[model samples]
Target chain A: MRFWILLQRDVLVAWRKKSNIYQPLVFQLLIVTMFPLGLGAGAQTLQKIAPAVVWILALISTLITLENIFKDDYEDGSLALYTLSGMSLPVAVIAKAAAHWLTTGLPVIIFAPVIAVLLHLPASAYGILMLSLLIATPIFSLLGTVGSALIMNLKNGGMLLSVLIMPLLAPVLIFGAGAVLETTLGNTPVGHITLLAGCFVLSLTLAPLAAAAAIKVNLE
Target chain B: MNKIVKFYHEMGSPPSFYRITGHWLKPLLILALLLTVYGLIDGLFFAPPDYQQGDSYRIMFVHVPAAWMSMFIYFIIGVSGIIAFVWRMKVAEAVMMASAPIGALFTALTLLTGMLWGKPMWGTYWDWDARMTSELILLFLYIGVMGIYSAYDDDPRKAARLAALVAIIGLINLPIIRYSVEWWTSIHQGASISIMGGNSGIKEWSMLRPLLVMALATKFYYLYSMLHRARSYLLRTEQNKSWVSKQFIEN
Candidate 1:
């Protein structure tokens, strides 16, 4: 009951702001547009690197809005209230990350095909690309929640948060991009997809607890 | 048994930890230095050159040990993190925070020496090989741990606890990262020397001995560095405590 209310409350709050929905999408489009401009719009080169380019862009754009996951709650004392409310903190963390994924990760997944077409990613790899993103981006939100909670109380924590989570995110990038690249080359992407899904499952079970512990430390 | 338990409890106290580690510091440093000098000499000059790669393979004396220490220190940090986070042991917190920079240093040394070794062996200073990529990621994990510790400057306790959580998370992820990188690709040679690999392991006693000695040397060096740093961390964080003040007067 509390989980749904918290999740609904977060979604409602994000919906009210509206920029929260569009900012990351715009940021994703702007950067996805840069690859063609900077890389000379060569279809061959763009297709070759498309999987990596798309995955990396997804990683960074999600990162840009990660702070908003916990920043407002931390500042307005809502996090403390949640802590004191005797509701489970990890449950709240999961709701917050799920809300973050709905607003941020889901848009990127939905909009990824446009980026894919722009990058000349082959029509063959499109489904796998979206599948990988579906698995990968939620892991990003889940892991990002832990990083965000850790530094939520600090000034200039944005860059530190990126540095903190980048190593953890590298495997996600490897498997996610590798899946699409394998598909582009006409190979079975079963292995890459399996590993990517494994990463998501691991983060799903463990990340909320870690994020809750970090939030408790910050509240202290 | 009673004495061991008593000593363990005493070591958890900050002042006792500082004093006990102080007593062992000089000997550990001396042992590390002596073993390092002996290992490098024997490995570089005394050990027969590798049949395939010749003397160039000698870089393993330094590279292999530093790589071992890099991973070993992280294991220690993770264990200390659990102790710190669960028990809130002050000594464990200091040890965990202090191990980060040392771990980072050894990790960097491993990468540097591996690159130098790779240039001759693999014809490239860098490769997206499995072991090397994982080592590079290990370096980043160390940097992240150190970064989180330094970020919360105003509150040492918060910093320690938060960094502890990060270390624990990294430790859990370490195997996943290693597996993913290994699955991605592998060009690095398989482990040449393993204690239990029997026939598949290093057969040449001359080469194996120096490598083992070098490994022992690095362990001593890590202990020396970790204790020295943890003492300073303890003194700084415990400055207001009466024991910390008394140490200055006694010294």
Candidate 2:
């Protein structure tokens, strides 16, 4: 199908730029390292706040890369061609968001355990933290597509994209962090996990349509 | 029904909308001013002090009404946004864009007044209470809407449509955000006043009457401000149209 081909093409294109993959990883690790430096490296304090810290780092690092989702294709005029190619725009949006997650979000999840060690997050929370990120980061990428599409034509859209999407992302941050926090508190994280999955499903269904609309608007 | 449909059709024209809203603006402003003056006087001095908090609770007169306006204006923005996006009506786009700043203003006022009252009663200026957090997010949503509109300065039509999309999305997310925050935790007190009349929010008629008056006043103020802004927006964007030029030349 064209969807898989488009997805593959995008992933391959991003993979060629090796720095794009490592930049967010390095950024996430650097931020993960800062908490200990600033918070005095106390294990108890770090343990208590580790989940939140990890989530916040993921959020910021992801934000750094979101504008790139549409900017490169937009600049090359390929986005317009994609639109006119008879491919479903929302389908193209999904392909782009998937590529985004594969490149950026997946790497963060893979490295989160190593980052978790720096903050002294307990062994018990490791699974829940990863599970929450697994469900939550795709929502981030989905929402990012909408934000990126909305301002793809602008010159300084990076910061504006964050302002536009962060409030919408607040619920995800809350439920994702809450799940990990619940795990640390020795409670059932099932409730938080379910709510997060709900959010993911909702964003998955709606965000692509919204992004497609925004892309059309920008193209006009 | 025919008259209503006719009016709707006529109002779709920017010139007609500007003219009709021009007629309503002065009266709406006067009514809003009169009601606000009376509401403040009656609520501040005449309404009995709360049995527990005494006079400190009076801030609710302003705070609660602004909070209501904030949410109400956002509802209007979302409805107008749907109209703009689906129908591509210029007036709907103008109205949607006009409502954002006013909504943000009211949301900020609500937070400010709430914080001022909180300091006296709860001994802190801010808390992460569910309502407070959700209200804060509402303010950000307003700012985001406005930010997108201004970012597309070169293409006003595109700006309006894109901003409408953002508003529509935010409207859908508002409930989700509120629910997630509530699920996180709630320290704020539950609603005291209900329209269904089953519970006690404000038992005193004197207090309730003025609060209602203030609420009405804020509604009028919102209409006045939104129309004023939309009229200006229409004039600026439609400057090349004959009606816009004629109105300017005649005035």
Candidate 3:
């Protein structure tokens, strides 16, 4: 009820801010493009490194999106207003996380295949790559919310957000990248996907509570 | 029970903790020194080497414990951070601050020993293997928490609270480090069923006994050092207070 409205409000705000939506996409594209240029234009070389490059770029892009999650609203006192609006702060936090995933994370997934092709990722592995990223990126977004909430009011919040969040995202990176690599090698990606999906489910269930608690602490 | 509660209350106060537990520091320090010496001597020289790995396997006695403590300390930081976040408990935050450096130290040791062992056994010093990579990330996570705590210029309470948040967030890596081999088809070998099941196999009782002693000793060393560091942090943070100042002058 209230959560959906809040989620809608978040989506509306994000839609109105085009740069906010496009910056990470552009960054992801730039990172994906640089690898081919740097490593030479050999298809074999690109294929070899595609999984790592794609996952790393995805990670950096996700990290970049995290900075704006709570910082803008907290700075503008919208968070305070939301708190005073008689809505559950936890629910509001979860709604913002969902909106963040839809706007920021979903674009990365949609754009990943294009980058995948550019990196010479096999047409065969595309299904597994997309599936794994679809499952993995949301967990990154959800976990990033906790880090963002923690540093929401800090000076140079964006850099601090990256340092605080990257290590926590390591497992997702490993499993997600491993899944893609497994597909590349003609091995079963099922095990990697299962572990990643498990991680995603666990992070989704737990991260909102942690982020909500962090926001409360920041408010105090 | 009442007396124990009273004792806890007294110890909960930073000044009292320093005054009361301060004397045990030296003895505990000496005991830790002695136990470490004994464990190293026994582990390095006397224990029969593994049938498969030979001398390189002895590195496990050091590497395994250090890895265990790294994960153990991170859990302490996370659990204590929860308490501090939920209840605003000052002592818990103090304990967390104390645990961070020690955790970092153990994490470094784990990596160092694992690399040493790996070079001899795996023929490589480094691999993107699950356990090794996850452990590396754990070290970075510790550094992040400690760095954030020190970077802040304002109220220690606020800084501690923020660091607590970082600790809680960073805890996501702990399980990953612990179960990396199980969760993924890692290059690292899986945990032996015997160790996982708490069964001692063909290993001599003499060897197992020393390892257990060393593990217990390391646990106590962590406690003693954490208490010492916490007391020092409390003294620094509370230095301007009358109670701390009076206690310092009296001592």
Candidate 4:
């Protein structure tokens, strides 16, 4: 009950501010367009770089907004009264991460297939690409919450969040990009996707707990 | 053992820590410098050059130790971080916070020297060898700890605790990241240039011996620098406290 309420409040907050959803989407689209211009519109070239390019752009998009996950609730004193509201901090962190993934991770996963097609990513790899994104992005959101909770006190948090989370995100990026790269090279992407899912499961269980601890520390 | 433990307990006091570390600093620094000089002279001149790469391979003495220290320091940070978070040990917090830049330095040196080594061997300065990529990410982790520490500078103790948490998190993530990176690199390229290819990464005893000496030298350097940095950190953060004021008067 508390989880739904907090999750709903976050979603509602994001909905009221249309830019929260819209800006990242636009950023994703702009990066997709910029690649061809920068890398010179060679279909073969773009196709070759497409898997990494698209996945990295998705990572950056998530990074750009990750700081806001805990900032607003923290600033508004909601997180301070979290224990008083009879909600466990870890459960609340899970709810917050879910809301963030719904807003940020979903759009990127849904949109990655389209960008993959535009960048001439092999048609055979599309399913694996989307599948990888579907598995990996939630972990990204979860890890971001872990990073966010630790640095929520910072007024300018964006850069610190990247440095903290980017290294942690490395495996996700590798497996996510590798799944597509594997399929492009005519191999099964099962290994890559399996690893991605493993990362997801691990982060799912651990990230919220870590974020909860971090939030408690910062609030106190 | 009891005496050592008691000594540690006494050293945990800020004034004692400052005084003891100050007394040890010169000896530690001199020991590190002497070992480093001997290791360099022996490793560079006395140790036989690689038949394949010749004199250029000597960079490995410095590069490998830096690489080792880069990883080793993270473990120290991780242990210190756990201590800080679980027990709220002020000394552990100081150690964790003070270690970041030194860790970053070693990580950067590992990359810079690896690149220099790579240009001759791999025919390119940067090709994302598994180790190099991992070191680069490790550098980011160090910078992240430092950045978070500075961001919380107004509350120095809290900053250390928070930075310690970040280090612990990064430590947990390091292996997963290393696996993905190594797997990804092998998929894209092959196994990296082995340090001792023919010897299967265990070099001839002649080569191995000085490398060990250099590694020992680096350990001393780390101890020297860590003690110095932790002392300065203690002083700066504890400046308003009476112990620090007394030290100022004596100085």
Candidate with top TM-score is 2
Number of the candidate with higher TM-score, 2 or 3? 2
Q: Is candidate 1 or candidate 4 better by TM-score?
A: 4
TM per candidate comes to 0.95, 0.97, 0.88, 0.96
Candidate 2 segments exceeding 4 Å error:
B187-199
Residue clash pairs of candidate 1:
none
Which pairs of residues collide in model 3?
none
* Per-residue alpha-carbon lDDT of candidate 3 for residues B1-251, written as tens digits (9 for 90 to 100): 99999998887677777788888888787877788888888888898877766777777777777888998999999998888777777778889999999999999999998888778776788765666767888888888888778756466887788888788767755666457544554432444222212434536876676677677667878988998998888888888889788876786
Leading candidate by lDDT: 2
Tens-digit per-residue lDDT, B124-150, candidate 1 = 898777778899999989988889999
User: Please, what are the lDDT tens digits per residue for candidate 4 over residues B1-251?
Assistant: 99999898977777788887888888888888988998899889998978888888899899888999999999999999998899887777778877888999999999999889988888899978788888899999999889988999788877887888888888998998788888988888887776557345545888887788889989889988998889888888888899988988988
Candidates' lDDT values, in order? 0.89, 0.90, 0.81, 0.87
Worst 10 residues of 4 chain B by lDDT: B194-203
Ordered from best to worst DockQ, the candidate numbers read 2, 4, 1, 3
Those runs of model 4 whose alpha carbons end farther than 4 Å from true positions after fitting are B198-203
**Cα deviation of B202 in candidate 1 (Å)?**
3.3
Interface C-alpha root-mean-square deviation of candidate 1: 0.7
Best by DockQ: 2
Chain B TM-score of candidate number 1: 0.94
TM-score of chain B of each: 0.94, 0.95, 0.88, 0.94
